[model samples]
Structures are given as C-alpha cells and as structure tokens.
Target: MSRLFRDVEGGPLCPQGSVVCIGAFDGLHLGHRALVRHAVARAQALGVPAVAVSFEPLPREFFGKAAPPPRLTLPRAKVEGLLALGVDHVGLLRFNARLAAISAEQFVREVLIARLQACEVWVGPEFRFGKGRAGDIATLQALGVELGYTADEIAPVLLDSERVSSTRIRAALSAGDFANAARLLGRPYAIGGHVIHGQHLGRTLGFPTANLRFGGKVPALSGIYATRVHGVGARAWPSVSSFGTRPTVDGVEPLLEAHLFDFDGDLYGRRIEVEFVAKLRDEEKFPDLPTLVAQMHRDATEARRLLMNEQQRATA
Candidate 1:
C-alpha cells in the first residue's frame, strides 16, 4: 500500500475507477478493518484500486483548541498498519480550515466524483462528514445516485456482542484492561515517540530509564505497565515502564520512563515504539526515593518473570 504525505498535489489520484473509504482511522481497530476490507473487496470485484482516505491531526484536534483524546495509533503506526492490510493506497489528507469548510456535497462532487472517479464509496454505518458534520449515509446515497456511483455503509464489527470502537479501546486501556483493548484493536496497544532526557533519578537508583516525548496525541493508561521496547535490535526487549508525574521527584508533565533490561545504548533522539503487554499497577506517590527505588526493583523482577512466561507460552 502507498502512504501519502501532504506533498502529493493535483488532487486525488486513483486508477480509472476506484472504490474509496474515508475516516479518521485513528486506531484502525476491528471496526475500521471490517470497513476497509469491504472497500478492498469491492475494488477487487470491480478491478480497481482501493483507496482509504484519512485526516491527519484528526479534524476535532485541529479545531477544538484543546488536547484531543489520546490516540491509539499515531500517524506512522497507522500508516504501517494500513500497509499491512494490503490496500492499494492510503490518502493522508492534511486537514486545514480551507479543506474543512468544503461542504459534504461539494466534497463528494469534487473529491470523490470528479477527482477520484470513485465507482463505489464505502463508509461506516454512522459516518458523517462535510461542513459541520452535515452529511450522513442517506446523503451519500442520494449523491451517489446523482453522480453514477454507489454508496454503501458497512455495519460496525462487534466483539462480545458490542461494537468495537476507538473510544471503547481507549476506555479499556485507561482502566488497565489491556487484554480487552488488544482484542478490540487486533494487536497489542503501543505508543511511539522520540527518546528524551529525564531527571536521571532512575539512573541514581540504578534503573537508568529512557524517557520518551510523545509526538502525536497523548498516551493511554497512566500507570506502571509491562512493555516491550523496540529499536534496540531485531527483537523488542521486555521492559517495565511507568507513565505519570513522578511524585517522589515532584515531577510535572506526564512522562514515560522505561528501564530496558540489559540495554546500555544511547537512545536520545531515537524514535522508539513501546508495546503494552500488561498493566502492573496504578501510578502512586512514594514516601521517599528509597521507597520508590525498592518498588521499582520489585516491578523489574515481576516484569522479567512475566516476559519469560509470555515467551514460554508462545513457544508452547
């Protein structure tokens, strides 16, 4: 699949006729996968390219003026996951006020109809778009009839009789129910960012953590978690990570400090991906540095044991 940045000009460039689906696709959860798969299937049947359109910064975050909710997948991760899904192209639209104001009618006519020449448009059952979220499935269908195209709404994919959504996944993660979140997401929950410097308290305590600065939206789950760190080598190393303001140090601004087992490389400025395997505890304030250090040691040992169990289970 091809991933487009904002640089590609000249409007939508799809093959002669294409099937397209558009959404924020924040997490690319099971629900999104179902919709995307449907669009791809339709494209295959029509012998056309399947194009997935997604907005960067999400429309809400751009206009809301407040920090948007923590996203499950950042742009890079989203693009990687989309490519793995085997779609023909992913349109990463840069959302600006000008593009935002385009009426739903005009969007369909200009982007979908004239630009992409889409033969079929697939959207989620509850999909809404255009100025002020004014368009719905019926509007799309009506427009499709006028434009010689077909509009189809794919029902949400359900898990345990409930629809899987990015919101639900976020809630589950915040509650530290990673198993359930992973089930909905179809993969382990991960956060991506560049390694930044920390207070070096962990180093003084003999932990030596690599602090990460969030690049996309915020992060889910503010607690201690068992994680797997990537970018150290071919395999992701098991780690124990804490996400919160270090109360013992009177720290501010939530930070993720991960102590990689047996790792001693300079990771500053390196972009790394950390996958959440399990949650160990909620963030808490320790009475003193000694107490915090003791708790960290316990966390490390437990994390190592859990990682071994996971590896053994996989082999079995």
Candidate 2:
C-alpha cells in the first residue's frame, strides 16, 4: 500500500495495529514535532507502524471559506513533513461536508478503529475533533477504553513559557520576524513548490524569475522578501521573493516568484524551497511599468544586503 492515504474508509491500513498521532500540523512546528516523535518512539517500542492523521483543507479552512485562515503549509508540504518525522504513513483525510457531519463516536469507530486499526492514538494538548468539534482527549480516551486501544495527549511544547503553536508562527511571519518564527518552528519559514510559467513580464523588466503557485490556498506571507532558494544546487541560492497576487499585473491568485541573484538557469518544473529571510515591504501596485521596474531595482538591492548579512552571521 502507498504510504499516504486520503479517505476515511479503506481496507485496514495497519491491520496488525499501529501507533497514531493526530493534529492539524501545519508548518510541522516544534510542538507538532514532539507529538509525532513521541508516537514514533512508541510505535518503535511496540514494533508497529507510526501513522500521522491530519486533514486536508483543514477543518477551519472548510468551515471558514468566506474568510479562510492563512495556511502556513500546503497539503503536500504537510504530508512530506509528517513522513519525514518517521511516520510510517500519513493520512491527509479529505474534509468536506460529509466528513464534517460525522459524530465523534462515528469518527473513532470508522477512522480510528475500522480503517487504521490504531493500537494507540496520541494527540497534542487541547486537540478536538468530530462533528461540531465535540471530541477531545477525553473523548479519545473514552472511545479507546471501549475499542481496545489506548489514547493520550502530550503536554504542550513551550518557548519562553508560552506554547509553541502554528498561530504564533503565523503571527511571527506576518510581523516579518523570521528569527522568532524559526525559533518556534525549529527552522526558518519557507514555501516549496515546483516552478511554473508566469506572465513573462519579469523577463522584460530584467528581473527574470521562477514562479511557484500557492495551490489555491491563502499564504501566510504576502509581500516582497529576501529569501534563500534550496534544492537548486549544492547550497542555498540567495534571492528576492514575492508571495502575493501581482497587483501590478492584475493578478488574482497568490503566487511566489523568486529571482535568484547573480545566477542564471531554467527552473521550470524544478521543485525548490524559498526560505524567507526578511520582509522587504507589503505588496503594492505601481502606476506604470517604469515605476514598478524602478521599485524592483531597489527591492533587489535591499534583498541582496539582507541575505549577505545572513550569510555573515551564519559564518560567524
């Protein structure tokens, strides 16, 4: 069977039994890492697979369609990150109206017991689930008692006495505080996707770029930034990046466009990660192409300086 599954109904994925961790897990921040790690450890000791269960279109995203919350990471990134944390399988369950309407008891019996055959289920603090968000750790524990399994919640991971959470990370990113975001995430904030063709206007402006789409999801950052592009060469490539709808070009969908400095290459179809270093400015429209090009020049210069300082600090 594939290591990833997307449905609530399926043949037994881990028929023999499995250890499980559940969460929204956007960004796979430090708190999330702790939960997955603990589950992986338990799975190892018990000689079973460690599975991570999370929802795509997350519950909040589905219910808040009119004003959807910003997504810290997209579906692919979330699954890849979960698997990287030693999970044997990652379940990005589709969360639509049908799934949302199921009661907590049905969720446990259908997903946890019937599908996963979970031997142990783990969740982070204050985790809730099922229709109307009725399920909690106590819910899981109660269901486990009747279903011949064990359920437990891990303590919240903290920094400076405050919980490390995706919300905190998003706030840090919004504030252009990459350092604080990284501290909470245990790494810098980045968005990764395969390069796609853009309008080619940047080419005419002398700032050719590699563009990436946000999978029709709201991105946490929406502005020009100094960034480092990874998965392009032996080392991270310094660059300037923009993550927003291109107001100057009449764009309506969020896009990530990175201009690698002092380099030349074709990146179409190449998967790369854009690590945000510092925010340059909020996205804005220009009066004309000439004005936009002029501002682009200034943005590039500032980005280069910021990335240079980062390199210096790293070496120091």
Candidate 3:
C-alpha cells in the first residue's frame, strides 16, 4: 500500500527518510517515469523508501485558469500512475495562494526536511518550484548540504531524438497524432474517472453514453474519437468518445462522453478509463438536434470502422 499526503505540515511521513522525486508529473510521461525510476533506484541503494512529490492543480493551472493549458492527467490518475511506477509514498501538496507564496527555503525546510525527511532529492533537468519560481536544482543541492541530503537532476528522456515531455504529448494530441503521443507517453493517452449522471440527451438520440467530468481542468484534446473503454470486462470495449463542452447542447464544462458499441449496462459511479485511439473530428454545433444526430451517426460509423481495423491489425 502506498501512502498519500496532501499537505506538508504533517509530521514526517517517512521517518526513516526517503529518496524523494519532485515535479509536476502531469502526464507521468517517459521523462517523468525516468525521474521516478531513478529516485526508486536511489532509495533501494540507500535502503530508504521512494517518495514521489507533486503539486495539485499544477502551478500553471493555479496561477492561470481562465485560459489554462490543457491538462494531460487528472489528480487521481496522476496518483495512480505514480503508485504504478512503484513509488512507496506520494505527496500531492495543495497549490493554493499560501503555497504559491512560500519561499524556496521554507519549502525545503518544511516539506523536504521535516515532513519527508528526505535522504536524497531527485528532479528533472528543467524542474523549478517555490514562490516566483525561484528554486532550481542548484538551490536544492545547496540546501541539501545543510539538510543532510543529496540532490540531483535526471537527464531528460528522449524519443526519436526528441525529448519526451508532457508538452510534446499535448501537441501530438492536439494535432490528432495518437501514435506520436503514445510513443512519447509509452502507452495510449487515457483519461480515468468515475461515471456520473448526465442529461441523458445521448440516450434520447438512441446513443446512450457514460459521462465523466474533467474536474474543471481544460482537457488536452477536444474532438470526436475512436476509443476503447477499459474496466468493463476481460478486454477493452470499442467506443466512440467526445471530449469537450457540447456547444450544440450549450454545455459550459468539459465532459468526456463515451458510447460503447452494443454495451447496455449501468456504469454510474463506476470508474473507467477512456483510451484514445484516433481522433475523428472537432466538436461542432448544429443548427438543430436532428442535424446533430445525423452527424453523430456518421461519427459513430467511422469510429466503428477504425476500431474494427485496429482490432484486426492487432490480431494479425
């Protein structure tokens, strides 16, 4: 079992000390994974637990929400990804105004030295933190000398001669290049959340959907897509998905709606992952509900065709 904490005020979560890795870890992409893996290895060598530290709401999202950058993963997914990467402890510090105003020295003294009792601190090449973004690897190393810890930054993970990063993954997704995004991510980009009740508009149009809200964060991609819904059975189910504010329905918040082919089960309150396979088209507003329905039929048909081909290729 992995321990999780949302604040730094608590007493040492790892009293024996830990090898801690800190970053935004928004997508847990290849680079992020490498950093965590390095920390885990260092922890094993030092006989201490490995701790993964990140900020909730992300610093960028906290400072700029009006037109915040698209998020690669939600809070829950981020935590799950960290635990999956073999982190013994996960700390998602709250990133509010108070935390934003904290000094680099204070952050190190309270969070790293006191709460985590870090034996070593690990970060990426481009990592920065503290108030006004003043902290860097140099700052961490300087403080670590007095705090009885070591600090080091891991080299960036490269793919196809390019660095693997959340920004690159977002760009690939925006351009409808799932293959490129997957290559960088080391797997298909997927959104996981619990299903919630919706307006049932899709059901009325003869296409029922399982709805998942994006938790008030901007999604990295917005379009109709050919997808696979996991957590239903032994295998992933083929689906057509839409991720955006439904302009035709006057929706204000971004929602992910996935309609599984030939699936008729209760999904409310069930957690599921929507794995994006390929983008279909951008979301558009129609003049009437009938027009929207017609367009949806076409989208579903195309998604089915693409998914069928993908399955056949996999078998081959």
Highest-TM-score candidate = 2
CA lDDT scores, all candidates in order: 0.84, 0.93, 0.93
lDDT of 2 at 22: 93
TM-score of 3: 0.98
lDDT: worst 10-residue window of model 3: 8-17
User: How does model 3 fare in lDDT?
Assistant: 0.93
Looking at model 2, residue 154 earns an lDDT score of 92
lDDT for 16 (candidate 2): 89
Residue-by-residue lDDT tens digits, candidate 2, 70-97: 9999999998898888999999999999
Q: Which stretches of candidate 1 lie over 4 Å from their true place?
A: 1-9, 193-201, 245-253, 268-271, 312-316
Q: Which ten residues in a row have the lowest lDDT in candidate 2?
A: 1-10
Tell me the spans in candidate 2 whose CA falls farther than 4 Å from its real position.
none
TM-score of each: 0.88, 0.98, 0.98
Question: What lDDT is obtained when candidate 1 is compared to the true structure?
Answer: 0.84
The deviation in Å at residue 265 for candidate 1 is 2.8
